[model samples]
Target: MKIQVSTELLDGCVLALLAEKDYYGYAITQRIQQTIPISESTLYPVLRRLHKESWLETYDESFKGRNRRYYRLTKAGTKQLGVIRNDWESYKHNIDWLLKGDNHG
Candidate 1:
């Protein structure tokens, strides 16, 4: 069964990817595909939203005879990533505890 991925989780993943290096839409989608099952349609809006939020910056580079827009994380994006990481950590901890049937009083 395919599990549903949340929007916040998707945003965090995209931010983390951009944190590593700038990538075009296709490349970002490909990299994300390695770990999660996401499509171009889903990723494009995320990119647009991030850019609109000032968490991401874009620049176009001439590749061969075409232009490719690349995305990079901004200072805000890095900070956002940090927040997401912390949230994920806490969430995972709680879930793990619940799954392991460990109830501490």
Candidate 2:
């Protein structure tokens, strides 16, 4: 049986946050929970991967004398969000039809 969340889910969460703000790792970790709750450990790797792939960009800021890495959507990331959001909508549409559950999603 297919189980566990997919990497696409990780990408979706990242795209959602990047669309919202330039967030530090900790802030991204927290904001992602609003929709897709995931652990700090799980998130760092995904964020790293996205940044490495050039889909996301990172910048630093001084907050209380500490430099923190922040993540934001690159042009690529913004472009990908449109594609991914369409895919997600189609997936949800089919799933909703089959399940007939509340459209809380």
- Show the colliding residue pairs in model 2: none
Best by TM-score: 1
TM-score of 1: 0.94
TM-score of 2: 0.86
lDDT of 1 by residue, 26-100 (tens): 999999999999999999999999999999999999999999999999999999999999999998899899989
Query: In order, what is each prediction's RMSD in angstroms?
Result: 1.3, 4.7
- TM-scores for candidates 1 onward, in order: 0.94, 0.86
**How well is each residue in 1-104 modelled by candidate 2, as lDDT tens digits?**
43466798779878877898788998888887776657999999999998887889988999899999989899988888888889999997988877786645
Q: What ranges in model 1 sit over 4 Å off?
A: none
Number of residue pairs clashing in candidate 1, backbone atoms closer than 3 angstroms, sequence gap of 3 or more or interchain: 0
Q: Which candidate is the best by lDDT?
A: 1
Q: How big is the positional error of residue 105 in model 2, measured in Å on the Cα after superposition?
A: 26
